[model samples]
Target: MKLWIKLAAALLSGACTVASAQNFPNRPVRIILAITPGSVADAIARFMSQDLTARLGQPVVVENRAGGGGAVAAEACKQAPADGHTLCMLHVSTFSLNPFTMQRLSYDPFKDFKPVTRMFFINEALVVSPAVAARSVEELRKLLVANSGKFSYATLQLPGADYFQAGLSEQWGAQVIAIPFKGGGEVVTALLSDQVNIGYAGAGNFAEHVKAGKIRMLAVNAGSRLKEFPNVPTFGEAGIKPFKIKAWWGMFAPAGTPEEIVNRVNTELSRSLADAKVRQYVEERFMESAVTANPAEFASFVRQDYERGGALVEEIKRAAGNK
Candidate 1:
């Protein structure tokens, strides 16, 4: 009699889990943003919410919890119930940078959340204000060396930007001040207003300004010259070896969420992102679609990135010391 009762209980528990997964998102679903509005992450989240809502039979909302280099949003996601209802849109900074740089991180990317899929990857570019007389990266490097300690570079509070500033300064035997901002939008604004003479961010951020002749794009990390600016050289072509790093935005669910539900969301995201509109949007934004094969694949990718972040942190510190 005891054994029968135990088996019944186990069967009921399994049934409950299955039901929970199937009925996932019975209410509104929220995708928290780790950065400020007007960022590429925000744009992509807002763009996909409608489609996700329709597919899930529930409203999908985007909430910005920007600050602390993605800590605020990450904490919110970590504290949320381990259900499919709450998700977060995190980026390279959250998974790759903060773990190694922050003195105290509130959550672990691997322990606190489940990676759904990588949404997109962006390539960084070096842009200078029109006030600067450099037309190309070589020219800019010479200028920086000649005018050491006379320039300031604007960056989002992430290691990638700071790493570049440090690496370039050491390479060119120059010293450029680093001014950190809260978001990409702020960095772009600073560059546009000439508040900073140098800026490093997604090439998309400076596309229009470059066209307007307000800023000059010296080089990009896109592996080749951009189609839009055929004359602009890649970092490799400009004489800098390719930086072995990636900047991507990915979706995550609170840890302990059912694998079934996680797969469901991943499937929907894949379908939604396959739309022609999304592809066009990605291209226009100067990004590449980076949907992973599955959740496990994304998890593996994160683990690799986390390791890379640690090594890069050490390299960044060394570069800073050399500067």
Candidate 2:
């Protein structure tokens, strides 16, 4: 009789767990950002967060934890409960950049977090200051060769930009040393001030400067010709066959979060991201909506991206004579 009572209680507990999973997010949800509030990352988070609030029938809040190259926020999110109430907005850097560049990371990006959904992916642009005379990749190659060690190029460490710039230098046999900045804004500032001759960063960072004609983009790594710069060609079109670089955005939850809750959030995220306004905002910023259908597919993509980045890191090290 005692044995029967124990079995009944176990069944009841399992049933309750399933029902709770169905009605998850018993309270407000918080989204943590690794960068500042005004960045394109932050803006997208804010835009989609509104739809998330409505779709989930819970208030969604975004908190900025901008320090340590997103490590600060990544750490905070990892330590939180796995109830699906907390999610972190990670850029390509969180997975691709930090792991390759930083030797000691406080948290394991792969182990400590579970994929929620990809947010956006944008191409990088190789732009030069107006002070420089290069107009094309070929011309820039010649310039980078002539300038060599005499010139410096700006990049950010957050997204592991060092690998991209280093690879470019190796491909062209240019010995220009890479200078690391905190983020894209600093890269743009260095270019504008003539503090650096060349910069590799997000298309959005260079969009305004390029439009104002303050800088010239030699080539882009976009899926197609950027609508804003219909005349410029992609890196492949420009004969840069050895390398292609892109920036990405995504969301992650604590590792132990139930698969059911993960799928549920992803479902709502896909639907909300499809809203006309949010889609328009993403499109206008030279970003595309995530093509993932659910958490499993998105997790696969994140893993693949990380693996690809590892290969690039090794290639760059070999080319730069640093390995």
Candidate 3:
């Protein structure tokens, strides 16, 4: 009788666990953001949260941890329970650049996290102050080469040792100085104040300034023209086809999360992306919608990006050494 009772208890416990996993997200879900409130990442998080809440019938709360260039929130997500209720909305830097730039990271981006789905890809643009004599990308390249060390370009950080700016300098053979700032807003301030002659950041950061004619956009780092800046040519269009980079954003769950729960979250995220309102919001925000990919496909994409970014970082380090 004792043996039978113990067996029954074990079976009941296992059944309860299975039931709970099947239902999934029985409580409010937390979406962690690694950047400050009112940032582009935050805005994108909020947009997804609203659509997700409506579709899932549970509130999706966005919590901002904001420090260490997204490592704070990323580590927090890493420590959270792998129950699918806790997830993160991470930018390109979180997975690609941070791993290469930081000497020590608390979590392995690929090992500690599971890819859910990509949200959007934001194309970066190269902008110069009106005072700079560069109307096009070709002209900008000539100016940068001619001026060389005389001019400085401001960016969010020290080109991350593997970031787009560092790679760009190597490709162009220009010795333009790099000025590191705290955030995108500061990059703009440095440019406006004449502290920096040129800047490279998200197109969203310069959208308003470009519209105001305070700064001139030489070229975008996209394969084609951006909808928001139809007049601004792509690097290819401007005859500098080698310089192209797009920063992407995606959702990730902690590693060891149940496959069923991962699928559920991916399903809801796909639904959200397909919604007309969500599409419009992303388009207006200067984000290109991610091509629909299932969990396995998304994971493969992440791995490819990781390897590509690693190679890019190596090239950057080599260039930095030569300089």
Top candidate by TM-score: 1
Residue pairs with backbone atoms closer than 3 Å in model 1 (clashes): none
Q: What is the lDDT of candidate 1?
A: 0.83
lDDT of predicted model 2: 0.80
Highest-scoring model, lDDT: 1
lDDT of 3 by residue, 162-254 (tens): 265665577678777777654566677777888898888767777888999998998887768887788999877776545223578888899
Error of 3 at 109 (Å): 1.4
| Each prediction's TM-score versus the true structure | 0.92, 0.87, 0.87
Worst 10 residues of 1 by lDDT: 157-166
Q: All models: lDDT?
A: 0.83, 0.80, 0.78
- Writing each residue's lDDT as its tens digit, candidate 1 over 142-245 gives 98899988998987755443557656755677888788777777788898888999998788878887899888988888866789989888888888765557
RMSD of each: 2.4, 3.0, 3.1
Tell me how far the alpha carbon of residue 43 in candidate 3 is from the true structure, in angstroms, after superposition.
Answer: 1.9
lDDT of 2 at 284: 80
For candidate 3, give the lDDT of residue 42. 65
- The residue ranges of model 1 lying beyond 4 angstroms of the native Cα positions read 1-13, 159-161
